[model samples]
Target: MSTKRRIATLIASTALLVGGTVTMGAGTAAADPNFTFKYSGTTSNGSFTVAVYNNGTYAGLAEWNADPVSGHPGDAMRAGDVLSDGWYVKAILLSPYRLATTQGHPATYLTPWKTGDLPEGQKVEMRVAISNGTTTYLSQYYTGHA
Candidate 1:
């Protein structure tokens, strides 16, 4: 083969290999959707509601199992409203491989009830409040990627 032709073929092969690697990495990242917060714990914290926010806009609230059949969890929020649900979500135990402390913690699986399709690495904040008619617990803030 001519030297120039051989060089061209090598360049083409390298490009193909690089492209294939990038595509495969993206697929792996997508498949392992990371949940930002896993809820857990038992307190007289009252009914729990969860809403997802991207930037300053309200994405939506989880319909949750309580209203899974109905498809709407009965309430929606505007840009600045405090988000809540009529009940508390179960908490999750972080993977043993993870460094998160498991002591007295409750874990809630959030993927089932979270608002919408959240792309990886988007900055998000979760606000949670527990209320029991006369008493309302303070809202807690958890910020991370989704």
Candidate 2:
């Protein structure tokens, strides 16, 4: 009711709001450290490589490919194959599907992979599946930590 009392109440409310926001932000940042997914190289005879990192440390690696089968135009890779590295074929996002003959070439997809939490400063290796057309294969090395 009094002007001085009203000013004090407003200041207290502002302080509480700012303090709560800062606390919430700090908690969230501490709970989730930044992680990254970095991949490179193309399928060589069907194999490819990918890497995962947590806070700039090596988290995991996956190298995989589809094996070429005799007589068949495509490798053994499929749309749902899961490798030991917790990576799997998400979907055939884009390809030369409309062209009947170009189907044997490599296709690209926005692959999605999921894994459990990684302990700080630790890493693990695992196999991942890559596809060339309809064929899929496993990576050669392991590299992920949890």
Candidate 3:
């Protein structure tokens, strides 16, 4: 292939890869029974809610932001609220090889969660990553649902 053609091909390939990654982490519910799901949010001392809907053709997340920012709903966690905490997303599960973090992401809280098009009807699994602003630690994963 020519230089220009090669560059174009590489760009297209890179775009495809990046696009694939984002879609995989999306919060939207899928028809695939084995598809995984992910969720994220930014909160302070307040708590948030995660509502799951798997009925008919309408299946996705319906999160209610906490007080001072309540009375609204969104598809993405918190929709677009840039709270004190940066962002804490659901964690992965049961991988032999894994990566760890010592200095946690800038967040008021963390949920080391079980995700991936989360299995229908199964309790969502998660862990708490307590951070002292600079350092962090992980907790054992627990099973729960919306």
Candidate 4:
């Protein structure tokens, strides 16, 4: 084969190999659709409510309490905290809590969630975190809809 032709063939073969590898890796690296419930708020010493709505109708509710921690009052819920039914809570913190911080991502294998227990196409009103009483902090809401 001519030298120029040989070099062109080699380059073409390398490109094909690299392209094939990338195509295979793309499938593995594809991210799964994320369904998460997340919220954050402040409270000195009070209780907060996490509520889920479906099609403008009330569906479920979960509550957490804020108590004193390190001389600062706060509340938090961890991942795998099962709400009523199959609702699970997962929190991805943006940063470490300072004090009086309450936050988490809540989702479930139920209605109003992808891969949820409930059927799809349900209109989720809002996932809201509210702090009330004397130690009321800012109320946070999860704006994502299912």
The best candidate by lDDT is 2
- Which one wins by TM-score: 1 or 2? 2
Model 1 Cα lDDT, one tens digit per residue, 1-146: 96434533553465566552111111012222211222232213212234433233342332212211345331111111222322222221111111111122232322333234344444333333222222222123333333
lDDT tens string, model 4, 1-146?
96434533553465566552111110112222112222333233333445433333343343333443554323332223323323233222211211221223343322221122212222222222222111111112322121
lDDT agreement of model 3 with the native: 0.30
Cand. 2 Cα-lDDT: 0.32
Scored against the true structure, residue 118 in model 1 reaches a CA lDDT of: 40
Across 5-99, the per-residue lDDT of candidate 3 in tens digits comes to 45335534655665521122233333332222233443442223432222222222223222323433221122111123332333222222122
CA lDDT, every prediction?
A: 0.27, 0.32, 0.30, 0.29
Q: List clashing residue pairs in candidate 4.
A: 37-105, 37-106, 55-123, 109-116, 109-117, 110-116, 110-117, 110-118, 111-118
lDDT for residue 129 in candidate 2, whole number 0-100: 27
TM-score for candidate 2, please give it.
0.26
For all predicted structures, in order, the TM-scores are 0.25, 0.26, 0.23, 0.24
Q: Which stretches of candidate 1 lie over 4 Å from their true place?
A: 1-112
Deviation of model 2 at 127, angstroms: 12
> Highest TM-score, which number?
2
Q: On TM-score, who's better, 2 or 3?
A: 2
Per-residue alpha-carbon lDDT of candidate 2 for residues 1-146, written as tens digits (9 for 90 to 100)? 96434533553465566552111111012223333344454444443445534356553443333333454222222232222332232221111111011122333322223222333323333333232322223223323222
RMSD of 2: 20.8
